[model samples]
Target chain A: MNDVITLAHGAGGRQTAELIDRVFKAHFSNPQFTGDDAAVLSIGGADLAFTTDGFIVSPPDFPGGDIGKLSICGTVNDLSCMGARPLYLSCAFVIEEGFPLAKVEKYAASMARTAAEAGVRIVAGDTKVAGKGQVDHLFITTTGIGQCLAGVHTSGTLARPGDVVIVSGDVGRHGCTILLARNQFGIDADVTSDCAPLWGTVEAMLGQTKDIHVIRDATRGGVGTVLYEIASQSHVGIHLDSQSVPVHPSVRGVCGMLGLEPLYLACEGRLVIVAPECEAPAILDVLHRQPYSQDAAVIGQVTAEQPGRVILRTEIGAETMLPPPGGELLPRIC
Target chain B: MNDVITLAHGAGGRQTAELIDRVFKAHFSNPQFTGDDAAVLSIGGADLAFTTDGFIVSPPDFPGGDIGKLSICGTVNDLSCMGARPLYLSCAFVIEEGFPLAKVEKYAASMARTAAEAGVRIVAGDTKVAGKGQVDHLFITTTGIGQCLAGVHTSGTLARPGDVVIVSGDVGRHGCTILLARNQFGIDADVTSDCAPLWGTVEAMLGQTKDIHVIRDATRGGVGTVLYEIASQSHVGIHLDSQSVPVHPSVRGVCGMLGLEPLYLACEGRLVIVAPECEAPAILDVLHRQPYSQDAAVIGQVTAEQPGRVILRTEIGAETMLPPPGGELLPRIC
Candidate 1:
């Protein structure tokens, strides 16, 4: 079997099998794999939760992470935000011709390490190769299966009047970092795109409050869009104070220079939560205790009046409706 | 809430939601899709099966199908072959900028219709737009979830001595059709690719026999590669009669003219089954009852001697080990 992958490696034959057994299984294999159609695991009467996401970030490799880590954490965080116990993942990669094996290996290794760190298994996977220029280096699709604990009911449409929307941590870090990495912008800033699995942080928050109504990973459209969605879904209004939202100085500085709005940029490691106002402090306390959640803040509050609207309180105390992003301001920044 | 998709359709905001609600959700919405972080489904009291595949076929559309149908059926067939009752699918689309809305809609509608006909629900989905040239046109990633029936356990590694190999139908039609469509060698053929979903045929076979030891879709490298995989996985020898394997005359003619081997050409709606010898004839009979399986036949038999080898009995009665195709003789045929 060839250690290096060619187009034939994904041609559904000996090379494909060997690649699966050697390169993939050798690194991510575990007992739960079962070699069956699906991983069979007992969840002690918990509800089954499944999430699937695709990573098509250009360059495949980025400053903080590559497609592999994104593939793993993207779905794992989806499960986490739903308060599920992340368990297993199925990865499917579509690589373009001429993609270097060394890069693929690096990405695969990162995925294996990330899955291990998150206490999950990459149980099964599929791979395909497309002609050159048909795909952007490589694309990864990950499907995560987890178990939702009993009494854990989360939904975007569950927020109520007088609910608090807390952003788990800093924003715009990921978007700014990727932007700088791509454009060769000479910005001397210690910023790493926040790409991480949030199951641990989610677990800590769940320990403090079961009344959390909604949880959303602010990935694509950032906190502002996520808040707007929650407000619309929950049929409520959301109010955010400019000072309360956690935005790192670097992100703000970069946004100021680039005329970019941090609220419209994507973030990986951060989550937005809407909960009863009374439970906001306790929830923030639990989140603040973790290193990943140290910068968590009470960014906003949910209100029943003027449902389906989101308002931002400016520095001068004037409020303005914050509309959803008109378009993808930054693509593939995730 | 326009029915037609715009450039801002995949922007992850009002337009994205409207597209989901107006077009996608109209066709795909089920009780499982609660507009949440993930779909909630129950797999209790049943064995769960999962499979994922990506489609990046060139031209995006072909004689009989497009990336849409391929994405749905590929994973569905994988699940179906495992004797699993596929229930839900997650669709992820990576669309290139400036892709014709009509073309994308055609693909999406095809997918939605295929899922409906296959008796499965599109429970959750994601959409992303890439810059022009980032993707050829559109690539779709689909993940399927199925429930394995009680008392039915099937695997590629289960074939044993005295088992029989059954092919559901003719081969090479898909590959030849795609070749013709590409106008390779200035050849034109009115033949349509065999791109139908195989769930119905598979369900019929499962209804007749639960003793199927192995089932594989004859794709990519085709029959030779599929049997080789089963043999290696099951550690059994497979003996095939070259003359017994059914190939449509049109496909054979195309292959002969192009110096291509029909045995290594792809087939979309086909399955290779290894069954107990006593059940082979019944399986063939059941398969042939379906229009798509009219050419179903007992192409080979499993043997213990010389395990992990696939031997072909030529028309002249001489036997030779059939090697798996080194690479895809035809690419993007699926």
Candidate 2:
């Protein structure tokens, strides 16, 4: 490990995992400590899911959502991934001293609106101010608590050999939008982030079938990284139907212009779900009826061969390995 | 309100309250929304307490503890304020890109040790890295979940006339220690922060009796601010026996040198507890027997006169009103 932390240590890839294992996991090792999206705990005779995320997006605002909206959606989606019903959330803010009060109000309004849409209550919060230049614009960390539905268990390690891998909606819009928003590449694009609270989308699929094995939101390191993690966790190979993966035209254009793989870009509102192959159509049917997952598609399947690897089958019927995610492609994209 | 945020706005005094009222409360108004240390919620057939706190104390490491230890103590104390047994916590960290990995490990170790002492599990966590100068060093936000003790309802609004106010220990060490650590004033005295997880302290009192009306950690704005807040919330007056208030000798010397009131300085591990006069001795007995609250002393009592004001009676038989806390006395003290 490097003596000093680098951006890669926060990239949500191999480096991040290594940092976690050496520092956090080393000290915070406990029975309930989680490597999953949220920690599942039995509290007060009830199964509960808890998670936390910090939002430090460079520009605080983008085409589809701002930091406040993204903060709520990020934690909500995390709980949703655990097959939990989002219930209550607490947000703590560390604002730069000179940040505008009006902008703060705007963010608060966005948070309230987003929390309401997700059917979660914003219950408690704390605010702190750092000296100007001591902090960037502002950062919001939100923690969520949810109730786990009975008999519904979803984890990255639960993927089976015959499970079909499905994505709730189009990918790469979020990462692409953030990249374009940076305006460093001199590329003009009309792409907006696919950032939305996704409890409804997850609920729709769970309502259709409880056979879902693994569910995860592709946030920091995107769908490709998520597949690698799930594959490693479940000890199964992931075989992707490359052409079947959904990507917005604008996102595709942006990725093409920049020579970036769309599959490795972040998506705030999408979920990579693994379930029995027979339940795919029914789950997709329910997802298509929901607002956030209308573009749900079966993009891959879990395979017994080549465990811990992700294979992408191209249009020419050729297969290649998707390189494992490492390094910091974009910092503060979330 | 100012057009832009100021350090005063996060001072945990009048300005912070105004910000919470104008922005947070205006947008997040709901029945379960909190004006206290933690929100009381009934979830999954059990009463629970939820709260979040952000720690950005300058000089991440201080005399008594670092940011990690303070983070756990802050959230645990918040839950303890509500008479809840803290069960779970989630921490989110936003670190500067060039922070030393060894320092991060040290903080993590402190957090683990503190959490174990508090008997709470560090269940979930997230990490994000900002650019080198984007953040001062690192900031941690911890959210806690606790089981609310049955029939043990404590709130700032529950204080009544004749309720005795007790300080769990000598006050002002934390704020004084941080002030000295900054080396701005060129005045030094040996003082350490009173930062500790106080669930055991609160539990001891509850075991003795559940009649405690209010329990609040005198943090950012100190015991003075908490007394004023309780006075306003309960619509009662507070009368202090000034000489009876416990203050460490070094802290008192520092406060005297700086012309600061020890009562208005922060104490992380101390609690300003209010309860009926009849229960004061029993509560004090329990607090005095605890490790962190050995200096527990009766500092004041709630009164019907001078509602919303705190009066201090001196040993010379003189009475003076303790100024209401406002403005920025010290920024990022906790």
Candidate 3:
């Protein structure tokens, strides 16, 4: 609705949704188009998922990973969220005129390692350079193709009452890491980004049961945003036992000092999963054995009442509605 | 290699190839990785082609096309070069914080129109915003997946001795258009960009024959760079009847005035097609009937005598080698 684009339009929130609806979806409407992480396509008897993401993180390097690692994780997680195994990736880079070639090599090395770890091939790519001041240091846009797992269907709209909600790992570490990396708040906290590829974690969960209800990555706007999205899309209420939500100690310290909600901070490697409560034990059992998801736990459940709302039960037993996810939280966190 | 990235590294010439080899290919190499327009992928029972291109053409708008249209055309043409029918496209945009929403909408509309013409669906997309002054308005990256034609095969390494080289249309218009749009040289010319979605042109040629040896779009370093690439890849020399290379009058005028070689300029809508001399008639016939290639003409022939070289026979019947392609031609000209 704004005449000019704002940072909120890229914040993965309500404004981002509106822009997609009014501009992109309005013009690019078609049968196979998807608002989910990836578009599912039936090609030559194979079900496939295709997705793309652009990374413009302010500080290219963070505590746990650089832009290259983050870029691969972002797209791989998107495919994983669709119950798809990422197979191929294409990377396109736009480098500013005077950026260091060694840094480029470093990023490429990181990407190669990440892609190998994810069992995905880097098949095609393009590179362009903009004159100095015309672009930031570097930006990467990665597109991934994946094979959708048979007998498994996961979508934000599939959440149902009585389904248990699971967090794959500690929340808000990535957002907290980025904030600290920028040093805008003059805070020194020993927080590292949760920026790992999640295909293995998702695979572990699906190995237990293919009857998962919804699976979504908490990337730009974090677990709180992901929950709000699933709740609205599935028309189910999310009731969170807020005290049970996992938060790393340093991240909790940073959030407490900054007066920020840990739930609303970004998590590059975390997943907000909803599945039948009966299957939660098996899913959690497998997740607990996984590398990136050792902190997996059931922190909430889908509710029949208060549809489209997220209610949090505090430690003192007071209940409050989680703020609807919107506005500019932080730009370029991923 | 330069310690820092230079404009030449992204100019799609020798320096660009060096960067790709020393950095990207060294790390990302795999059986499916490609140096061609698109990577040939076998999925299930169908052969597929996947490609990605980044468009950072400065000014965003030009005479005949905007960045949005150019993005679609670039990806579509890349897939078409592989004799593939482009099916699905994923677009990602990186926008500056305060770019006009209307411009974004306009570009989206242009992309929709071009994708419709190319018979491809825009299925998925992501948007990220950089802080103001951190980016040059916006950059778009489009990734396309296409079904490879059943009986056709094309590659830069497939050119053979005695094959004829053909230009799909007038050369250098896109480059000329961008040069004028920038107003770097104060020349008033009527050149419009040759930027177009060219799947139809390739389709028409394939319908006539499936034995096309190689197809390449002339962007960045233009026909000269593409020719040089093919010459070395296929270990063949190209002998050009220089006068026969088609150049629109306005474009010719601009190049003549600027002392720039039209052969080294970009053509977004043109194709540098190589095929057996015997197959030239049918390929040229169909190209002539196509909208994008109406002015298609035979420009040269491949020879085994001088491998890895390109010789030009001028109008006065003197032979000279065309300069090898390298260095910065024009930055961010798509």
DockQ of each: 0.11, 0.88, 0.91
Please identify model 2 stretches exceeding 4 Å from their true place: none
**What value does the lDDT take at residue A238 in candidate 1?**
90
Put down candidate 2 lDDT per residue, A1-334, tens digits, no spaces: 7899999998899989998999899988899999999999887788899999999998998999999999999999999999999999999999999999999999999999999999999999999999999999999999999999987989999999989999999999899999999999999988999999999888888888899999999999999999999999999999999999999988888888889999889999999999999999899999999998999999998999999999999989999999889989778899
Question: DockQ rank, highest first?
Answer: 3, 2, 1
Quick one: best TM-score, which candidate?
3
Q: Which residue pairs collide in model 2, if any?
A: none
Question: Candidates' TM-scores?
Answer: 0.86, 0.99, 0.99
Candidate 2: true contacts recovered, fraction? 0.85
lDDT of 1 by residue, B102-195 (tens): 5665776788677767877665555566777877777888887777666776777789999999888888777777788776578766677787
Q: Where does the lowest 10-residue lDDT sum fall in candidate 3 chain A?
A: A200-209
lDDT of 1 by residue, A1-334 (tens): 4332233332222333444455334432344332211233343343566677778776567678878888888888988877888876777677666666556667777887787778876655555666777778788888877777667677887898888888989997877777877766776676778888888898888887788888888887678767776777778999889888888998999888878888877888899988888998899889889867899999888887778888899989999887655444667654
Q: Give the alpha-carbon lDDT of every model.
A: 0.73, 0.93, 0.94
In model 3, the clashing pairs are none
Q: How many Å off is the CA of B298 in candidate 3?
A: 0.6
> What is the C-alpha lDDT profile of model 3 across A113-210, one tens digit per residue?
99999999999999998999988899999999999999998899999999999999899999999999998999998988999989988998888899
